[model samples]
Target: MTEPQCPLHEGAPRNHVLEDQCIRKGPRRGMIVASSKIYKDGSAEVKDRLKDGFAFEKRSCMHCVDPGCVSVCPVTAMRRDPKTGIVTHHPDACIGCRNCTFGCPYNVPQYDFNNTWGGIKKCQMCNQPGVERIDKGLITGCAEACPTGATLFGTRTALLEEARRRMKLQPGDVYKYPMGDVSKPDRWHEKAVPVYHKHIWGEKEAGGTNVMHIGAIPAELLGMPPLGERSAASISETVQHSIYSYMALPAVALAGLSIVIQRNRSQQDDNEGGQS
Candidate 1:
């Protein structure tokens, strides 16, 4: 039997060659090229790039609007800023209970099990006091680091608009996609937009998220699981509120139980007195 040729061989003179063909070609030789005007003018130039079906995907923070980590943290280590809508954690207060790990739907919270002290760590969007990227008018490391505009950082609303715009583009059209932080000026790349799958992953997953993602592949294929409309944190809060809606409810229940026990004790005391 003959060995298969590498699909990415450069001498094949094609975009992609089969392993059995033993060919080579230049990069993107067969791949569709995007229009340069899209980057220059900020418009969608392509549509229907997907030879296969497409799905919509967006880059978003894994934690939903109301995050499970914020709700289940025993030491109040997990906190969400109302204004920025960023979820952050205080490692000093964290007992390493791993509650956040169990609570998160996306399984984003990671633990440093290898540490001698054994602590938990996860992406806080590089928002430490000195390393505040968003506050400093910069994007997170991942967004800045991404060579392709695959991951973008911006206000939730603006990112949604960009996603919608891309969905409208015809395949093979070039689009100038923003890179780094959307709130501030940063690096940008112009490239042909691939046929998208048609769903923004973070737009409404578990009631939305701050970060968002766009991808050529289906999110499910990338290990992102399906989720319900309501975020896990929202569900937990509703249950807690229902049981403790009113402070008086617990107080009243406690009083009634106490009264019944007291009456039983009094009856027993009377019976003992009579026998004596």
Candidate 2:
């Protein structure tokens, strides 16, 4: 038992424990893609911020339906799990070309160019390297560890519903929201509800994403990528397929080669006559 004046609540959550390495481990090892904050007092607040005053943004992968990260990888190092649709990187297959980093519109991929043994990095959403938290019927580390029900995991369908429902709620109203997976919530976090920030990230940007987001910060601050309904994969596929579909590109190449050969032969014949 503590003193009467001492206020004791539940425990605070730890974000992706592995994520700290990305944020603060070393120049070569650490690369922070996500961040969080706490207001000293519930009364203190920032404009366009979550009303409850706690703010965090995990700038992880958009997990695009047609991800460039997967398409641009020459060695097939990056791939999307067909069953779960999680985009993941396979280190063994990687040739370290860094095409994925350049191809992605969201700038989600990370490269450890500082080390002698460099590697590509990104949040696999706990689905990589056989972690399979989703397949094992569990949730992501950030989602499970989030005490305020801030980070959550679930199908795109359920998450969108929860996000839309929150937007309709009255701000400042105390509400008990589900934590972890929305379908089978692990726990609850009750707080004075904050006003919706007006966007549910990863919904349709780049043709939608598996892991979604909703928070106070608008456009730039959220590190949200500007994308349209169509994914980069679709556009690339369309162009490549159209060019090759009729074998027209091959005809063009053959024509160019024939012209070069004819010019070479004509020059050689002229040179022989001059020598004679």
Candidate 3:
């Protein structure tokens, strides 16, 4: 996908959909994004992985139900939509804290270091205002721009069912896979199916994300974050609440310290009396 502008130096890969396992946000030098943007850094990638051993991976947001970025945000700037399960950020409300950059394990959020005024930019799922394409009954821009039906947009339920259906199909068999929105049959275009991976990414990672993926290659090669079923954000928040609930954290710590100090004083007094 073409970025709003070239975030890197004067000449760099403009916009391309990568399915390899390379990290999107690599080490950078100041405002110049000098990270590895190529499909294959060494012998790992460049093109799509076939069914033999190479797996083609799509790099995108996990959109976890309990994203760490959202949890760590000082403000409620990063929030998940209760109904649609879409994670979006509000620029006006954003304080440019960059807590999200550190919070995310996948590093999906892209910061435009070029301009000091720029806020964090990531795939808001085309939910930007005045471009509510999903609300307007159209698929995401990426899905629409996909000429050969590579990228697709649909409900998590529909996509999961589609993935399950594709898994049952035998290799080398000609099956028409839906290109666009799976919910609306009329919007879909048929294409030859590629062998799908047994596992579906985002199904259970970090308590599961709404945007799921099923690829030919391992999910790791595609740059998806390695996460567990329980979301890190959820666990961290739960632990924090348990420790600090009712503002008892400070009180408990103080009480314990006081007891220790009193015991030490008593022991010193007993030693003096015995010596006397």
Question: Compared to the true structure, candidate 3 yields what TM-score?
Answer: 0.73
lDDT per residue (tens digit) for residues 1-276 in model 3:
323222221122344222222344443322221122223334554233432233333444567788888998898888888877777777878998989878887776666666669777666677666567666776666565554455667888888888788778886577776666766644444545556668887888888887777766556655555788998898889899987786797888999999999999999999999999
lDDT of each: 0.61, 0.67, 0.64
lDDT of 1 by residue, 1-276 (tens): 000111111111232221221111211211111100001111323232233332323222354578889999988999998888888778789998989878987665656555688665555666755567667866666566666576667788888888888888887789887776665646778988776778887787888877655655555554466887788888888888887877778899999999999999999999999999
Residue-level lDDT for 178 in candidate 2:
95
Alpha-carbon lDDT of model 1: 0.61
- Count backbone clashes in candidate 3: 3
Write model 2 residue lDDT over 1-276, tens digit each, in one string: 111101111111222112312222222223323333222224536543534343445555678888998988888899998878889888899888989988888766777666588877776776665566667787776677677676778887888999998878888898889997888886898877666777877787778788777765554444455678888888898988887877887898999999999999999999999999
TM-score of each: 0.69, 0.73, 0.73
| Model 3 whole-model lDDT (C-alpha atoms) | 0.64
How many clashes would you count in candidate 2? Answer: 1
Q: What's the CA error at residue 113 for candidate 1, in Å? A: 1.2
Candidate 3 weakest lDDT stretch, 10 residues: 2-11
Give residue 74's error in model 2 in angstroms.
1.4
